[model samples]
Target chain A: MHLSPMPSAIVATELSKTYDVKVRDPGIKGALAALARPRYRQVRAVDNVSFSIERGDAVAFLGPNGAGKTTTLKMLTGLLFPTAGKAQVAGYDPWSGGNPFRQRIAFVLGNKQQLLWDLPPEETFRLNRAIYGVSLADYTTRRAELVELLLLGDLIDKPVRQLSLGERMKCELAAALLHQPEVLFLDEPTLGLDLEAQQTIRTFLGEYRRRHGATILLTSHYMADVTALASRVLIINRGRLLYDGELSELVARIAPIKRIELVLSETVSRARLEEYGTVAHYAPPRATLEVPRETATAASTRLLTDLDVADLSIQDPPIEEVIRIAFGETEQDAEEDTVRTDVQRAPP
Target chain B: MTRFTRAMIVLRAFWQLNWLEELQYRGNFVASLLGTIFWLVMAMLTVSLFFRHTPQLGGWGYWDVVVLLGIFNALAGVVETVLRPGIGHLPTDVRSGALDLVLVRPVDAQFYVSFRRLDVWRLADVMLGLAVSGYAFVQTGRAISAWELLAFAVTFAVAIAVVYAIWVTLMSLAFWFVAVENMAALFDAVFEAARYPVSAYPGALRFLFVYLIPIAWTTTIPASALTGRLNPALATWAAAVGVAALGASRVLWRVALKRYTSAGG
Candidate 1:
């Protein structure tokens, strides 16, 4: 793989974004204070973050609320100009790339919609075809393919507001992908979707990436989406990149414990279950234990021999738990970090 | 193809969609027509009352003022048909961050936002206004020359430009004051002054309308062209003012767009 380096589809170097949020206290005093002499607070949304995504790679950005995931995505999509640092998507400066750059990339925000509320989804699809300058033949072909892949039948012809949330999101995806962009920046694409819809989208996205060899960077709260689609994960907290590596590597480093479950013919006490490892659950004939990865096999063998075990299984803990611990470790430390304003610039 | 032509193609698609959506609400056409007729009657009644009180207003006959009124209605028709529904949504879009969708497209954001919609029903107001102008011109018994007709065409286009420039400037203010949800109302209040001729106003107001706000150029100059009161020099000056207004508005739009932080960040 190192013999030929894959071209970078998206790159950011020391990207930073800060907003001058207006400050005001509570009640009439604050209103009067804002009128008398307005005050502003410098809030750093994304601080000196840098990462790059190679062509044909699916990457996931994970962060808590207000963690600069959206702010960074906006900068890369050319919707916001960075206060400091630089970024290039599809080999063009996102802020100044103009039509050439926009044509090569697509952005989909889950909560916000681009479709016309009063009109049918097909109308928006046609509008995008014109906006992206796609030919009639190509547009027809691509729209049909997306419709089939996403299982959107007559839903595209109905008004957007009339459709359910899941149906609307499916149409939203089709609308964004009409141009067949090489790079996709999806922000919470599966947010607020039902399990069935989420799974549909995840599967479609995986197939779409495989078919087009497109580069995708997504942010999702659902670990299932991350596990199903992304090959790499980037953990961001407090406007900084904490970890960027393979998902498996992150699991190995953050959570080095394996979970063991036992189905015994006889009921077991909590103390007996704890004798093997940390007792996760103890309910009659069924109990769960969290044991160190190095001793998980031995602990499972001992539990099987010592107790009247009927069935047993060992597996790594859920990715959500691992990520929760990752975020917890940095929650307090970020508060103590000093605010750096040396490179702050006026809003563009 | 050039970017402008491609943008036009996209705009055509949006307008087609708008037309289709408008077709779903056919009752609105009847309502809009009735509203236009009612306003026309009220406007003419107001002018009739003024005519009874005086032979001429500011040294012009009743029909001349009616011609200007007709021109005013025609321009208002353009606003309702195109500018109002299109650029009028800017403040709300900016506040709600809906403008993000427009910004991401390959087309020009200002151009797309300015002409993305058309109220087809209000287009009836345009034909009605023009019909009223023709009837009044016949009543004046003035045979229009080719030169005057040509000047009217230029000045009329200049009128639309001036009005559109006003809209762009007003809507651009949303980038700074995101909370001012209906900045278009301020424009409507100011545009009400363009109904009567600038000559009918006192010296201070005449100067304000002519030099400061420039609403006088919207209806007065174009009506003056049809009335044979416009000189070649004045028509050229009106054209120059139209271009300057457009240039200034475009510059303001660029500056203001940079300040769009996009809500829900």
Candidate 2:
């Protein structure tokens, strides 16, 4: 057997960015004092981190708010220079302003719009065609296909500001794809959209990846986007890459037990449920049970044979719960470390 | 394609898009034309009041001063048409993090940013200003020669170049002082001085406008070229000043961009 070199779309090694943030206290005097001799502080927006992503691979960047997710994305896109590290995308340094590298990628920032605010989406589409030097025939074909897939008919002709958020997002996604970029840096593509729009965008992205084989790195708060589009996820917290693995592997690592909910015809005692496994919750007519992942089937069988049950269903714990638990454990450890450091600085 | 050729393609696309978008607001063209005419009348009234007293303040006749005012309006049209809608949006773009979209483009950041959009309706002021200048030239009753025409074109380009450099210098400061979202107001305030000849001011004030702010080059030199008052020696100095202003602004832009850590997510 022969092994091939990794065909990665992105490679980052110990990439980091720190900011010199001006700290201001609340008051007129503080502002005046700031004008005189401003107090400055250092914020480690992204600490040392390293990761590589393969070509045509979709990865979800996950983190809590202000967890350096946006900062890391900005660094990778060459919007900000890293304090220490090297990053390469598509075999070129992104920060070097290499037009060839830039022409091969696209970024769709949800909070910041790229579409001409006063112009129709079609005009923007045409403008991008000229900038990216897309052939007329290719642009027309892609525009038609995207319009049909995204269900945009007359919507593309209307001014962008006239459209609703969901409609504008549909156009936004289409505009980013007009150039047919090889790598897409999508920051919350489905943000602030309705459930139906989110579902539509997710479906479109999944189908688009199939058609074009473009690598997508998306940061979205909606789990539906992550679970539907990306097979792998990167978890960052406090300027660190805490976990990088398959989505299923992450769930398995965090939760090794399956949640078994038992609806009883008659009242079930806690002691009776304890015979099976840990009883997460118990009530008069209902009992929430937890069983080991491997023995869920066997335990369900024994429970059905042993108890008078109205309904029994087994389910894995929700991904949201798993992540919350994971972040909680790490946050608590970080809190403890902070407390220790605070004590050391107290006397000095 | 060469980088310069590609930049031209992007610029052509921008103009077409601007035309299409402005077509939706057809009423604004008439409204803008009326507004420019109204301001022109007001400016003429102010000039007449000044001429009512002095035969020539700072050695310029009534029509000579009118030529400067026309040049001022034309320079203002250039500001409103191109620089305001384009580079004037820089501070807001920086604050809102919209510049991230620009930086990722295959185009040159500075060139694309400076000419991204045009206010088509405001271009009427440019034509109206030149018409006013031509109307004032007839009142000067001086024989206009081909040499003066060529000199007018050169000085007009220098005027535009200087105004562009001033706008770049002011707008780039937004990167350093992020709170200066209304920094363009400083330019408008200082540009009021260019409505008259620089010599109209006191010696110290004229020196400030000439060397420090360089607003004098924006209107005085162009108007003097058309009036045939620009000496051959001063024309050479005006050209040098235009180049120097442009070079200084470019240096300021590069320095200020280093402080841009871009706001918002």
Pick the DockQ winner. Answer: 1
Separate DockQ for every predicted complex: 0.69, 0.63
For candidate 2, lDDT tens digit of each residue in B135-232? 99899999888878888888898999999998888889788876665778888888988899988899999989988888888888888898888888
| Candidate 1 C-alpha lDDT tens digits along A196-219 | 999999999999999999999999
RMSD after CA superposition, every candidate: 5.2, 5.2
| Candidate No. with top lDDT | 1
Number of clashing pairs per prediction, in order: 0, 0
Candidate maximizing TM-score: 1
TM-score of 1: 0.89
lDDT of 1 at A95: 96
Q: Score each candidate by Cα lDDT.
A: 0.87, 0.84
User: In angstroms, what RMSD does candidate 1 have relative to the true structure?
Assistant: 5.2
In the predicted model 2, the residue pairs found to clash are: none
lDDT by residue for model 2 (A212-302), tens: 9899998866556788999999887768888888988876676677878999997778998999988977886888887878999999999
